[model samples]
Target: MRDRSTGHPRNAWYALAASAEVGSTPLGTRALGTPVVLYRAGDGSVVALGDRDAHRPYPLSLGHVDGDTIVSGYSGFAYDRTGACVRVPSQAQVPYGARVPSYPVVEEGDLVWVWLGEPSLAALRPPVSTPWLTDAGWDTFGGAWETAAGIGLLHDNFADITHVAVVDPVISPPALTGVAPALEVELTETTVHFHRDWPAAPLPEWQAKISGASTTASYPQREEGAFLAPGLWADRWDVFIPADEGGTQTFRFTHAVTPVDDHRTRHLWRVSRNFAPGAEASDVLRPIFESYYLKVREILETMQQVIDRDGYGEDVNVAADLAALQVRKILRRLVADEG
Candidate 1:
């Protein structure tokens, strides 16, 4: 087992922010316990650099973006997209060590990911593919939350869906409780996949409304999800309705977890659906999804607080924790290897 108090793996691609959030101004954020500043360059490419100025140790995010350069507000020093200090108003020649660390960044779908690991490894393994977020056929909507918890807790929470029955009973189907659905788990070098299929499961009110079925209707529900890496988790939900009642509908839920530090995490969630691809549907569904996520965040943060105060006493696991345990093992290995 890895030391939970140590920290997260540094050799991973963490989703730093939504693409829309970083436009022309410098967006200050943290990843893997490092303060990072993100901004768009002249060509509209996302750039991630050390948030502080090398000269006076002031936050570069507080500065202004000038074309392809960022002019520091504290010392009037200008840094380029590559983090090279190009202009210093107080001196004629730039100092030899005036450059801040520039992280490799990639914009995929609706999110911008920053690699805080070895720069060479970034090109070899990029961020996971999330086509549903960018696909025209899917209607997508979500936002980010700064949770007061460890990233590992969020990972565990997402890996085990059985908690949905207790944590989000209102939005989740009732069938998730009082019965054991057939489950299958697969593990790869960098991912863990879980599948659950339940027959004749009651549909939630919101889903029934979209499918034009009775609120008491029952259908076959299938859930497939994967822990792609340290920073990404994706799951898909399919409810098989009758042909007269809108046939079948699919929903994809993505959770992007980035550790602000050992005790804080930034969780970004997005939901994309194949049915009702329009702004009206998004407006109707966004609030429900947001509320459920906020509830989960509250629970996880409370758990963190309790554990911090009382300590993790004799933690135990059951059969349902297989996937989460596998994730922890993989994360342990990854963090150990990096050491």
Candidate 2:
């Protein structure tokens, strides 16, 4: 097992928040244990900087956003989007060391990503791309939420869906518990994909609603999920009712987990669907999908409690845990390489 103090990889782009979250006001949060402040500049581009003011230790996030700069409420220290301290209200000449660190940030996939490591590496890799998220034909809804579990554990939850049996039976039927899935694994340099099929599985209530199918009917469901290196997970779900070909619905679920600290993570989850696209998507299914994501959040919180008390490593591994195990191996390698 890796040390909690080891932290997450710094060279990767971590999703900080939804694009809309950083508007006129500065948003303050932690990513990979680093306090960061994000806001939009006068040109409508996202800017990221160290949240803490170097001089007074006040959070720059608490301050106000001036055109292209952040004006600290205390002492009136102002910093430009590049993290350069350009204004000192009391002094005529600003010292060279007065500037806060500027972080590289990019807005993509309807999310904002900030680089916490070597700035040069920011150009090497872009944020996790969810083309569906920004596509006009897909209905998208997402938000950020905090959870007690470390990012690794939260990601493990995504790599393995068998937990849905014991922890989230309501999302799907417990039949997946007794049945063993024939899993197909696809390995890559930076990501691991798992293809799973649940034959003749009864659709959950939420699935039924978005899929536009009868709740009682059984369907052949297929899911393809991938664990992206560093801290991202994406699952594409296809629910098909046997008789109705047009009734099949496709859902893309994406998760970006940023380790706030060793034991806490700020997570952004988005659900996109192609069945009902356009503006009407929100009016029709946003509420139901929002509730669905919240329910999973609650489940993860509960899982965190259990892990804190009893802990892992002692539990027996089953066939269902193969993908999760592989994810851990890949993550361990990524962490070691970073070190």
Candidate 3:
């Protein structure tokens, strides 16, 4: 198969899976079109390796994890965390060349990150970190789903929030679309930031709960959307709920898109809230949060399908597409720089 992953830079870290996904079993997945296997070492650190065995064609992911080694199911070949062939049952002595390719991996901020790039560059730039996921007094809920469109499309969608009208109209504040907030745009070497202030907007359930505002009232709000190099996007929305104590709640949404191939993308996402933290709050809100997240996932899947089915050439852009257009421009420039 053609490796479309070559179109993008390989000198950056990409999120492979959730931190909770890697455990006793070897998790089979792909990064930049390369087959990869993820597992935890004896010390609980995450390790990544090429899924294909050097001697045989069997995938190492199909094998089992035994302590610090992964045992091939077919020939009982054992490989260490470094992808070094430690034992070969079929032969008395393991050949020095019998080794699989090992990729640098790290677990940070509740996610597994693999560096599919130059070994030296891996240390210079780590994976995009979301501190709110683990910060004190913050509750996080996360889940991931694949899409048909490229990571660019997803990033564009986030940069432009107007889609909330059609995607999930019930939850999006009126100020998100009803009023045109002046956009403050900032561009750095490898990131773009946009901030907007809405003088009046209706608050959703989650926002209302923290703001202590009635559902029927419209309140002032602020939104900030940012995109990092490669494929990391973050959005922060704050609703100023009118309360006797004077309160405001901020919600953060993050997306890390890793290209699986030209037509497929693996998305790792999380939503963090500062208003509610710990089990007591989660016990009552988990179901509601999960329900909303599922809907958001569905919207992403639908967007990808629409893009793949219709193609970008057949679509048109409008005034609200300003942010998305900028994102596309940035991605195009970045991709060209990789070349």
TM-score of each: 0.96, 0.89, 0.88
lDDT of 1 by residue, 60-108 (tens): 9999999999989999999998899999998899998789999999999
Per-residue lDDT of candidate 2, residues 1-339 (tens digit): 323323577888888888889987999998877889999999999999999887788999999998999988786899998898999998999877789999999888788988898898889887777788889877887767888778877876787776665654656543475575788888876788998887776666765665566777677778789987576788988877554445677788888888888678888888888775566555666666566567777877776677677665455777767787787777677778887
Sort the predicted structures by TM-score, highest score first: 1, 2, 3
Instruction: Give residue 86's lDDT in candidate 2 (0 to 100).
Output: 91
Lowest lDDT 10-residue stretch of candidate 3: 1-10
Predicted structure 2, TM vs. truth: 0.89
Which lDDT value does model 2 have at 264? 86
lDDT of 2 at 304: 68
| Model 3 C-alpha lDDT per residue in residues 206-248, reported as the tens digit of each score | 5566445576777778889888757678889887765564567
Clashing pairs in model 2? none
Best by TM-score: 1
**lDDT for 76 (candidate 3):** 89
Shift in Å, residue 101, candidate 2:
1.0
